[model samples]
Target: MIALAGAIGTGLFLGSGKAIQRAGPVGTLIGYSTIGGLVICVMLCLAELSALAPVSGAYVRHAEYFVDPALSFAIGWIAVYGPCVSVPSEWVAVSTIVRYWTDLHPGIIIAICIVVSFLTNIFFIRVFGEVELISAMLKIALIIGLILFGLVYDLGGVPGQSRLGFWYWVEPGAFGEGYLVGGGIGRFCGFFSVLVNAVYSFAGVETTSIAAAETKNPRRNIPRAAKHIFVRVFVFYILSLFVVGLIVPSNDPHLLTSTGNAAQSPFVIAAEKAGVRVLPSIINAVVVTSAWSSGNHGILQGSRSLYALALEDKAPAFFRRTSRWGIPYLCVIFQSSFMFLAYMSLNSDANTVFGWLSNLTASSTLAVWVVVGTCSLRVRWAMEAQGIPYQELPYSAPLQPYLAHVVTWFSSFIMLSGGFYVFVDGHWNVSDFFSSYFTIPLSLALYLGWKLLKGTSIVPLEEVPVGTFIAIARANPEPPLRKKKGVVGWFGRFWWD
Candidate 1:
């Protein structure tokens, strides 16, 4: 549920317009498909690692074991920062949607949303998880409803409207003809940009692994969660993007509106064009829940990452302190601090703050993918060096070291090209450039600074301690799930892994 809800946030609801504006309809689909494939590959790699050695920090711990402590340090804090900013971005998103019905300041909405999410997370993990599950269910229902609504709106089901069909696709054509060269190159650039933008939306699909330490039978559960997440998120993103593009043209001025409401959503835009008067309010209301879910997810991820770092003595010990309920209250409080960054939207509009925060985290998310892929490769090499046959593992990812390398190189390319728009003539902006590519240098600085301070080196493959983790896994195998052999067996495979 966390994975489902975390990845279905403002990126799909709001930032998607920027993707459509930069790329055209067909191009946006292509970009999403390509990145979707990469996400699947990353998920596969992560499945193998997390199943082998499930832990609280998951990939960050994998990086420490397979790569360098310094590298892991860089990745860990960035992971923490990513969610920190994301919580506030979701707060900004809530305010963005709230502005649709009320004239209240975005800061007020931001405060209310963050306060609720903070209170929920500080006391009870189970309660927080339950709320997230409900949020996920709502998000799933709303997406399907929105997609169906878009289809009806697109086919001109509304009264007094002509059958639109794929009229927008032909009217504006497929490509948005970006500003790079204002032609095919711009279209291609636009498509390339979507590749990176989509990364942020897919950020939290690793939640299953994040929760691995608490999972009773992680080897079984993690694979099921990862595979299901891949299929579900892929379908939702592709179908939603297609429906949104089919209904509203990429060039719709409303797509770029500063109102910071769901009115800027292409789904809302399409319905309004079809003469539907009240759907934007409904969509915005549901979207506000998504924003809330998104913020809650951010707090969970950020606090856990910081707590993990503190456990490893990388972060201040204050973060390691917990409450009577075993909740990492101090870490939660620290992570919640970043939510105040949404206050920046008080001076600017919520939309501006959102774009800024999205750009800042987008590259870091991709960088994490790169690091994860690299760690998976190293883990595989360590296994081979230790003479552990792949079949002996609790779960094995299809396509071994090769897929890891492919995902690593591909994600690295996207990370490098994240700020490509800054290079486009007549589209220069310093803040845009800084926010888009800043994570790269920030990561490097963190890595180098940690290295200078601690002088940690990458673990060599032959020296990698694969044997110890493997022994632990062997001693404590994934608990076997039993059920009736016929119809129930099939569901057992999915639900019980």
Candidate 2:
């Protein structure tokens, strides 16, 4: 549920409207499911590896062992940087929500949001986890309720009108004119645009392993979490997106509303069209908390990532300092220091800066996904070449290197093509172009600079760290899955404890 919460927040609650508006219903589904496929590959490979040797910086540290120090340095710092950019973006979002009621200064709201998120992480790690669990549960319940209510409303239960089964689909057609460039090209471009939206929406799928060391039963629980991802993601993202698609037309101008709340939500838009007056406000309140939840998630990830970098000696030693409670106090503080970026929202042109930051975040995340697949390929090949059997693995990902290969190329394409819009003839703007493609160059600079400066080379295929990790996993056997005695046991078995 925490993983799901990390992935499904303001992106779905707020951004889905833009997706449907751009790609239409069918296109939106295709985009999301495509990215979901890639993410499944990521999660499965992550499960296999994290179960073997659950570490604080799961992928970052894994990249160091299985790939190269250069790559790990690049990825580790980017992992630290992801939340630096994301936390403040979320704080800005909180201020945007607050603007609906009071005219309180945006800077003040951003400061408060930042401090609140920072303080939450400053406490005991378990306390932060508990709060996150509660937040995740609330989000899960809200989404489930919204999906059910949406289904009933679509069937015309509330207003006693005729059933709305696919009515909006037929009227607006399956795909919109998109950017209105005309027929097929425009629709294809629209769908491609939504691919980024889908990527952003599924951003935090790696959360299961992000804090691997903290998990008491990581060998068992990490895989368990990964296995549930498909079902949970399908129900949460696909079902809700389909419902939103059904009730709201792709051409609806209201979707483009900059209300910064549920007024721009497709779910709320559908409810209003059905004459429901109160659901929008209820959902609007959830939207604010959703942004705050994202910020909280960022802080947790950011601090842990910095701590991992310090452990690797890739960052300052101060970040390695831990309190008596086992919290990496200095690492948390280091990430929290960047929270002032939220105050950029005080100026009207902050969107320009925020947009660039968002693209960088997206690019870094996409690169990490690609790196994960790469790490899997190297490790799997090494294990196989050395005569190791799949049965010896702690958790096995089906399809082996094929899944990794596909996701590797797939994510790389997204990262490379992020700046496609700039090449759209007249659509080129200096800021937009730089925002899209700058991350690619910046990442190369980090990787190559580290490689040359440290005189590091990629680990040879046969020399990958598969053997050592296998031993570690073997040394740490998890308790057998517990069996419960009643109907509640059945629920626990299928879902969770």
Instruction: Provide the lDDT at 191 for model 1.
Output: 88
Cα lDDT for residue 429, candidate 1: 84
* Cα lDDT, all candidates: 0.83, 0.78
Give the per-residue lDDT of model 2 (tens digit) for 1-497.
66666776766776678778878888988888888888888888888888876887888888888889999999888788778877776676667656655778778888788777777777745776676677777777878888888888778787666788888778787776566466888888888877777776777778778778998889888888876865687568988898888888998888755544435678778778778778776676776777887788888788887887887788888888998888898988888898888776666444344455566667778888888898888778878888787778888888987888887899999988866777887788887777566667777888999999999998887787677878887777778887887998998676742
**TM-score attained by model 1:** 0.94
- Taking the tens digit of each residue's C-alpha lDDT, what string does model 1 give over 1-497? 77888888888887888788778788888888898999889888888888888877888888888889999899999989888777888888788778778888776887898788888888657787788888889889988998898888777786787777888778787887574677787778888888877887887776668768888788877877888888889999999999888877888898756767667877677667876677777778778888888888889888888888999999998888988888899998888888899999888766777888887777778878889899988888888888878887777888788889988999888888888888877788887888888898889999999999998998988888777877888898656755567778887665534
Model 1 regions more than 4 Å off: 124-126, 479-497
Candidate 2 regions with alpha-carbon error over 4 angstroms: 123-126, 258-262, 323-326, 348-355, 482-497
Candidate 2: pairs in clash: none
TM-score of each: 0.94, 0.91
